[model samples]
Target: MRLRDHVVVVTGASGGIGRATAEAFAREGCAVVLAARREEALEATARECGKHRGARTLVVPTDTTDAEAVEHLARRAVEEFGGIHVWVNNAAVNAFGRFEDVPLEDFRRVLDVNVMGYVHGARAALRVMREQGRGTLIDVSSVVGAVTQPYSHPYGMSKHAVQALGSSLRQQLYVEGVKGIHVCTVMPATIDTPHFQNAANFTGRKVVAMPPVYSPERVARAVVKLVRHPRREVVVGPAGRALVRQSRTAPAVAERVMARQTEKTHLSRKEEAPATHGAVHVPIAGEGSVHGGWGGRRRTGMRRAAVAAALAGAAVAAGRRTGRGAPGC
Candidate 1:
C-alpha cells in the first residue's frame, strides 16, 4: 500500500477530479498513467504531475466507451509501469435534460461512458490484479448516485450503477477469497470542475454547479486516502454525506427536497443555452486544469452552513403555520 513507486492508472485524467487524483498520486511518488480522450490535455496534466516529485507519467489517449481502447490503455500502463497497483475509474460525462427531452443518443452516450467505461476498467484492472494478488480499484461516483436529481437522469442512473458495481465487486471478492484486492467507491458532492461546462445540455437553461460546490481536489485527496486504507465507500463532501444520510432515513423527503433544490439551484434561470452535445461523443479541445474557476474552499463551508440554516428556518416556519408546534418552533 506504500505509494513509493506505486503504479496507478487514472482514467479521465485530462481534467477535474481525475487530474487532481493523478497529481496526488504523483506527489506520493507513484508512477502515474493518465488516460482520457484528449491527448494534449493529458500531456498538460502529466507535466503538472512531473513538477511534483519529478513523478514519472505515461499519457494514454483513451476513449473509455471503446472497450478495446480501454483494454489497450490497461496494457500500456502495465507495460510501462510493470504492474498496476491502483486503477481509478474517473472518466464520466453528463447530459442535463428532462428524461424524455434528452436525445436518446446523448443519454446512451452518457451511459456508455459512465457505466460501461467503469466496467471495462474494472475488468481490465482485475485481470492484472488477480494475477499479482494485490491491487486497489477506485470508482469516482457522485452524491446523485445515492440521491437522484430532477434533470440528468442518465448521469444519476450511471452513478447509481457505479455504487452497486463496487459493492458487488467487494462482496464477490470477499467470498471468493481474493486477498489483497479491494474495490472502493468515492461519492462526492457537486464539485468545482469543468464537468458542468462540458456537460451536454437540453434543459434550455445553462447548467450550474449547485451551491456548496466542493473543489475537485478535495475529492482527489479522498481518493488518495482510500488507496492507503481501502473502504467499501466514502462520501467526500459534508453536504453530500448529509444528503446520503437523509436519503437513507427519509427517502420520500429526500426525493422531494432534491427535486426542488435541483430545479432552483442546478440551472440558471437567467442564462439560456442551446442544445449541444458537450464532450459526450467528442472530446472538448482546450487547455484543461483542475479547478473550474469556482470560488475557493473557504466559501464552500460558509454556503453549506447558510443553506442548512435557511432550510431549517423554512421547516420551522411551516411547522408554525400548520399549528403543529409553538410559534418559535
Candidate 2:
C-alpha cells in the first residue's frame, strides 16, 4: 500500500522499535497514531513524527493489556483519520530471572502485555479491516519466539505465543476468503533499545543486550517495508536468522549455547539494579528515544563476519543435501 496519507496505528509507541517505526511511517507521509500507556512519551513521539514530512500524528495513551483501551485506540484512529490502513502491535515487557526465581505475577504480566496485548490489537484491527475489506497488521515478535533463551523464560514464551497467534489469524483469514488483509510477523534479534533498562529485574544485576545488537531503526525499516509488501514473517538481523535456523536444525546444541552465552553476558554483575516491576503494572513517565546507549559499543565488524560465515555454511549444506555442487563448480 502507498504510505502517503495512509493511516497507520502503532502500539508501544512510547519508545524503542515502536517509536522508530512511527517516525519511519511519518517520513513516508503517513498519518500515524501513537499508542502506549505513557502519555508523556506518546506525546513526545507524536512531536517527532509531526516533524517528518509534515505528517499528522495522534497521541493516544493506551494500555494494550486492557481490551477496552485498545478498542478505543482503534476507534480514535479511524475517527481522526477516516480508516486504518496498517496496525503495528509492538507493546511488550520482560522480567529477567531464573524461571523459579521470578514471581508468577510478573510472568503473567509479561504474557498479559506481550501476548494478550497483541491479541487485543489484532482483534481490533481485524474488525476494522474486515469492515473496510483491506488493511495490514504487523506483529513485532522476536528471535526468541523460535528459540528459547535463558533468564527470560516469560519473554520467550510470550514471543512464541505471538508467532502462533499470527499464523492462526492468517489461516483464519484465508479460510474466510478475506483479501487485502495481510498479517505479518517481524522477529528481530537483540536490539539496542531501553528494553533492558525497563524490564522487571530480579537477577540483582544490570540487564544488557548480548553483543551484536541491531539498531531499532533496522527493525523499523523492516516494518515499513512490510507495509508495502507484506510477508508471513521477516527476521530482521542476520544473528536472529542464524539463531532461528540453528535452533531448528540442532535444538539441543542451540539450547546449550544460548544457556551459556546468556549466563555469561546477558547480565552484568558490576552494575547493581534493584528489583522493580518496571512498567509491567504501571506506566513510566518520560520522553523515550530511539537509540539505546548500547549502539556505540556494538561489535559490528565481527558480527558481519559471523553472519557471512553462517550463510556460506547453510549454502554448502543445502548443496550437499540436494546432491548438487557449489555454484561455478
**Local error of candidate 1 at residue 253 (angstroms):** 0.5
Quote the lDDT for 38 in model 1.
Answer: 92
Instruction: Give the candidate number with the greatest lDDT.
Output: 1
lDDT of 2 by residue, 118-222 (tens): 999999999999899999999999988998888889999999999999999999999988888999999998898889888998888888888668888889999
Cα-based TM-score, every candidate: 0.91, 0.90
Cα misplacement distance, residue 38 of candidate 2 (Å): 0.7
Off-target runs (Cα >4 Å) in candidate 2 are: 296-329
lDDT string for model 1 (1-329, tens) is 56887899999999999999999999998999999999999999999999987589999999988889989998998899899999999999999999899999999999999999999999999999998999999999999999999889999999999999999999999999998999999999989899999999999999998877898878999999998898889999888899999999999999998999899999999999999899889999976888887763767767778999999999999877788555564
lDDT against the true structure, per candidate, is: 0.92, 0.90
Estimate the lDDT of model 2.
0.90
lDDT of 1 at 97: 94
Q: Which ten residues in a row have the lowest lDDT in candidate 2?
A: 295-304
Show model 1 residue runs off by greater than 4 Å.
296-298, 301-329
